[model samples]
Target: MADVAAKERRILVAVDEGDESMHALSWCLSNLISENSKDALLLLYVKPPRAVYSTLDGTGYLFSSDIMAAMDRHGYDVAESVLEKAKRMCKDLHDVKVESIIEDGDPRDVICQMTQRLGVDVLVMGSRGYGLIKRAFLGSVSNHCAQNVKCPVLIVKKPKSTVANN
Candidate 1:
């Protein structure tokens, strides 16, 4: 078991437009903190790649078309909203600092790249996400990330909902 007295470790949490992301963020904020003091958290939101390609004539590539651009903007908006909620929850916790980043690409690749570039010590993310269709086709992002990143990855399963509500 890891010692609780260890120094603060950098944590990277992947966020997407989904309930799983929200649950993971909440769990990280509440559970992971510096033993000595506050620790920094980097939240990342990755947008799905757009359908664009290069021309056979070698003219240029068409990327981020009007529709894709709009979707990208929407993704940023969602990320910002999630960050705002996270900040609100952290108001009482002085030992945690949060930062948010939005990027566009394959989530697995982007997460691994960010982890390497940011020097992340731990990764906290949801085991399952809202991209069921994509997952069925492309495999789970968490799975790919777990296989690729060097650091330890924490995969949180969603809390089971009560049947009494129904």
Candidate 2:
């Protein structure tokens, strides 16, 4: 038999503050990664753009510079926390190389751009399980990426936990 070698792949996983994203990361670690394979896993966190409050608003309430600074700091903290949690999940996997990236923009656009820019083999993300109305209003990141990106997209949906009753 001819010798076969494992294909090297670059997998990108979009992570956020939600438990669904973390669950998707966990699922990817368990199911996609293989032992001794040359796979690079990238963790991406997209920060939303800062709100641009209009000065001419009728309310006439303006945010102080200190408050704006605090808001920016909070965003940074959240990004750091989320990335740290994702890194911890991949700590045990020695064979697969892992990296983290933080970008500012809409998650839907940023994710698609990153996948193309990085030339990822597959794009992995979690589904929020939004209802039709909610998804229509808020827009689904996973759905946008799934339709726009060139690579295969794997959207992992976290199953809701059930409670036992007598």
Candidate 3:
């Protein structure tokens, strides 16, 4: 491949703080580098929506504002931890410009929006994640992202289990 410009290609890596996601991040670092330049790596952690309920006539709703706040806080912390761990694992990335973002919304939707807004050329994400049940029924983040996002999407997965293969 020819040399690429540092700013030309933007890569967005979506992680859900799952160990499986680390493989995706590592894949991005190892594959996306240019011979004469480097590209931007954006780490995004999506915070699930907070429940909100109103009390009417002493009836309680399944909602909590504090829950939302906590989710946001946790998301930020996860983003910070992600960057720190990335640095620890891939020290060479120290010179490459990177951005850590924590956003609140549906993982698939937010990822798609970020890709469009940032003009991302490549998206690296995990095949499976923290919410296995939701993903199984609603659609996995990797599956949704592959179907919706315009850019190329890479789905990282652990080695298959022998039991499953048999």
Model 1: which ten-residue window has the lowest total lDDT? 51-60
Put down candidate 3 lDDT per residue, 45-134, tens digits, no spaces: 776553211222133344367754665576677767866775565556645667777787778789999999989989988898645654
Q: Each candidate's lDDT (Cα)?
A: 0.70, 0.80, 0.69
Q: Model 1 segments beyond 4 Å from truth?
A: 1-6, 34-36, 52-68, 162-166
TM-score of each: 0.77, 0.83, 0.75
Ranking by lDDT: 2, 1, 3
Q: For residue 80, what is the lDDT in candidate 2?
A: 95
Candidate ranking under TM-score, highest first, comes to 2, 1, 3
User: Every model's Cα RMSD, please?
Assistant: 5.7, 5.2, 5.8
For residues 70-101, what per-residue lDDT tens digits would candidate 1 score against the true structure?
A: 75576667768866765665566565567777
Which is the better candidate, 1 or 2, if ranked by lDDT? 2
Q: Against the hidden true structure, what lDDT does model 3 obtain?
A: 0.69
Per-residue CA lDDT of model 2 for 1-166, tens digit only, reads 6221265789999988878888888888888887666789999998766642222223324767786688778888999998999998888877788999999876788999999999999999988622343344448989899999999999998778822110
Give the best candidate by lDDT. 2
